[model samples]
Target: MPPAHPFDDDKLREECGVFGVVGVADAASFVALGLHALQHRGQEAGGIVTHDAETGFNQARRIGLVRDNFTSPEMMARLPGPIGIGHVRYSTTGSKGQTAIRDVQPFFGEFAMGGAAIAHNGNITNALQLRRELIERGSIFQSSSDSECIIHLMARSMGRNIPDRMEEALRKVEGAFSIVAMTRTKLLGCRDPLGVRPLVLGKIGDGWALASETCALDIIGAEFVREVKPGEMVVITAEKGVESHFPFRPNRSRFCIFEHVYFSRPDSILGGRSVYETRENIGRELAKEAPVEADLVCPVPDSGTPAAIGYALESGIPYAMGIIRNQYMGRTFIEPTEQIRNMGVRLKLNVNRALIKGKRVILVDDSVVRGTTSRKIKEMILDAGAAEVHFRIASPPTAWPCFYGVDTPQREKLLAATMSEEEMREHLEVDSLKFISLDGLYRAVGEAQGRDDNAPAYCDACFSGEYPVAPSDMMEQGFQAKTAAE
Candidate 1:
């Protein structure tokens, strides 16, 4: 048949990134800059919606990079307003190609309270069930995106104001959501009760901003205010400053642990911990747990570099660039077909034969989903005359697929789901392969006492397989439900 898709082989993809601003001149410009900083989170399509007194609502949506679409004067000129929201999307709930643009978000709805636009960053696990209920009740969906359910829910709410209506609508929804929304006069941000996604608040000159990460705020020269607390909604207006409301019953926070391992920008801060530092700590922990005698420690490049540095420092091994990545190469996982992905890995990475020849090499990477990429890289390393190849992973084996915004392969497809460490090492044709322990990962992220079995401090569903929120839609669709211990 066909070669497996690269994303299925190794990479886990996040769904989208959102940014919004209020009380700024040409607000869409700031929104564009913010989205540009977040382009790493999602690269397929981007859209910006702005609200102006004279222009009403202005929208620009396109299927490409932010720099390709939003940087042009003509495009910026089309979106003029003092309040705006933008979204960069990588489809998880919708189809791909031309038709997918219909799902490009900052989805707008004309509610009884006027118009409201929302940009969402996480997946709603119960969207399919909610959509069926809404459709039966006469709500017409404009797009196939799960995010559309929020707008329709708001449209049907009888709450007195937009905020109350939004709270009412969200209460009926389930799963991870970090939402940045805009109305005629307000900018809003809120996180799911479990805090499975991230949303931060920032301040610009006299205005306020909301973004999926703090790096988005840094791009626009905004001061970091704080995170939008879990289960809490923050509403900002020029006259009223900022208002906070608890829309869901308080629960233990369960921020996605993968944010520190992957997903987030190195410069961004999540849960008050620096992403870079956390990565380095993961490396240190990996060194302690699985030490290898090697000629050199080399990273897979970019994502694996920080961890490799920590590994080298902890083990007193020399760190070298044994594999160099093509800086200009597009993300190989985003290639549409399996054939392109089959050839894409070579286009993105090259072995430094000069450095790797005759060396006992240790390769560091964030995580391995499918064993394909690892196996390929091992062949490349062996061809370059490496005496031995050892693989050091920063995170634990990805045993479960993430249903909350992160795109993962089915459980049966995950290498870790079926293979033991020894079996994986042999399968990848490496001398040794070691992944960080679940407890080690927690320590790396600053949870010193390790993961709380009673109530996990972070959402590690991919590793632990214990979903904090019930994946109602998946269960209804016949996927087996699992508990943390299972």
Candidate 2:
């Protein structure tokens, strides 16, 4: 039976994350290490493709985490090459129910022009429209992901250079994306015009690496290089590394601010800001905005733990692990069929009755999506004898589905998306609930609005609907009604 939470809603859905390395003896091994670092961005499927003079493109993929997928020693030994690209995927727009090996990536195709394999992050808002158009033009699609559309488009573009062809293909598509492409002799990286997803370049010992986060570089002992500029494409080959300008001037980089707020690991660096510092800053700002009296400040677990530390330090509240997380549960845990999805939260976390007995507690969390998990956790705490549970969200309420890659429920499903703080408090049965203001969040990211000379940055569309790319469908749906909707 499918797990109770068949949707995998407990963890944020990562569209995908990519890694590429060249001129390394242990190219496949290093690529595996990089993918392991990026495993947090995606967990559903993993793959790697290598390039060598003997074999143009050798590949392997499986339906699980990097460690699970690349478990066979034979699989690693077979992938002998000095250059390669790896990927981890969690589908956003495609068939979430699919378990087919063909659907896993580093998708490769052999064309009259030559052969190329690709890995990508982000979702195309106009994918439906573009897919229909491509189909009409006789471009057959193998996978449901909007990502496949780019490859077909690249094949069709009649540009002079590979980079120009890539540019032409990107010009035809709209939405958030950060792509990495590999051929027999080249590795290429591109960011969406708005820079909604992140891509970073790194350098080491006459070789280069590209990945979704700086954390990956740190894992492989590569020196950090600059971020791939918004709307820019860079192609690396034995000959030279090529960078081209954005086709048109973008107003500013609309990077997914959530990368700092929740999606990225606290140890990574993004958009010139330390992800950990940004999260802590949010906690400090949240504490300043809404001071609560409590015996201890406790985090939801994992993602919420760093913010809780900040909140504890700023509010002068002692911090404690009021809830303990079960370390054994993973993507394949057997629970959905026998257990309820709402009850799934307890499989991973249980309230420590000893820690919260008769004490007022402040709960710090990154954000509340469907509210099922939060509600369940809150109930567990109260049942454990807490005098009161006050909830503080590190970021503003998320009211919109993220087309960029985040897997949020429909509008009406989000608790805060539909209701006010008061309404959420009543609904979740918490003593109080408060969220950080959008302004406070921006301030915490450590950048002034107008400071950066290249790329003015601000893309909080999930909170403020000022999208760099418009939704193909007219009306927005699926967010929850505000707590106090009248």
- Residue 417 in model 2: shift from native, Å? 2.6
Full-model lDDT for every candidate? 0.88, 0.80
- The per-residue C-alpha lDDT of model 1 at residue 475 equals 84
Tell me the deviation in Å of residue 90 in model 1.
0.8
- Candidate 2: stretches off by over 4 Å: 1-11, 239-245, 340-343, 447-456, 473-486
| Per-residue lDDT of candidate 1, residues 174-218 (tens digit) | 999999888899998889998889999999999999999999999
| Ten contiguous residues with the weakest lDDT in model 2 | 477-486
lDDT of each residue in 105-185, candidate 2, tens digit only: 788866556778888888877778888889999999998877888888888888765566777888888878888888777
State the number of backbone clashes in model 2: 17
